[model samples]
Target: MANTMWRRGVEWLAAAAADPRACKWEWDHGEGIALLEAGRFWDVLTVPDRLGLLALDLLWRPGLPVPGPTLVDTAAGRVGFFLPPDPSGGWVGSGLRYAAKGSWVAVPPPYRSARFLEWLIPPDGNGVLHPPGPLEKALREAHGALAVLAPMCGR
Candidate 1:
């Protein structure tokens, strides 16, 4: 089941890259596990944590440890992205977050160093976060950022 869902995430992300409406950070959340607790902020769980939580059978109504602002919402900026808290006071933006395994970030390929929230959240400015021009531009420079990440993700 996890493999199926993971595949869906990959497919959704691949489709997003070609979506005319898909901005710089667009993604489909129906492809991932639903959050036990919904919020703007979320912690990226490691494989062990994920297994442990899944074993709970999640009877509590409070919620799950998963992430959210799922791609289910078609409205602009409805997507939410969360990063592991840093000195930057956790994540301060909203969009399709990448909280894969042990990291809450994406390298967009070629970048050896991993970035926490900087991938989606800019260091400055009040410009609209969606379709982050800088991130998109950087990815474009590397022949499509998400494209490079897809194969690496083993999707």
Candidate 2:
């Protein structure tokens, strides 16, 4: 159920990106990632921002109202959107577990706004992002990049 919701959200974001006025997408090399910020939440591009990357840490308190995405400092530098654990208790949690690849920290409140969600895309060995097989693959690859950023969860 949650997966479906997540995927649908991604589709919607992608559609929004397709919409000329929805989101402004750009790639940042200094940050070693791609970013997409929309004026509203639930935008499809926000899906990658939420699922593709990892927070510097996972200090988010469960059951707390996120209001929106959160930003945190990370070994990779700064990552946005520290998604909370999915209520489904499925691969979502395990998929987001701290890996040696990236740092995991809390997303500060001031940064927790609808416009703040940004996707982090890792570059390949050639320092280029390779398109993955599917949306899930793209998202996982983004997460893998996050692992490369921190490589160790401070927590």
User: Which lDDT values do the candidates have, in the order given?
Assistant: 0.27, 0.31
lDDT of 1 by residue, 98-131 (tens): 3433342221211111222112222111112222
Candidate 2 lDDT score relative to the true structure: 0.31
User: Which pairs of residues have clashing backbones in candidate 1?
Assistant: 36-63, 36-64, 37-64, 80-95, 81-95
lDDT of 1 at 18: 29
Which residues of candidate 1, in runs, are more than 4 Å off? Answer: 19-66, 69-155
Predicted structure 2, TM vs. truth: 0.26
Clashing residue pairs in all predictions, respectively, total: 5, 16
Cα RMSD of all models vs. native, in order, equals 18.5, 15.7
Off by over 4 Å in 2: 19-37, 40-59, 66-76, 82-155
Highest TM-score: give the candidate number.
2
Number of the predicted model whose lDDT against the real structure is largest = 2
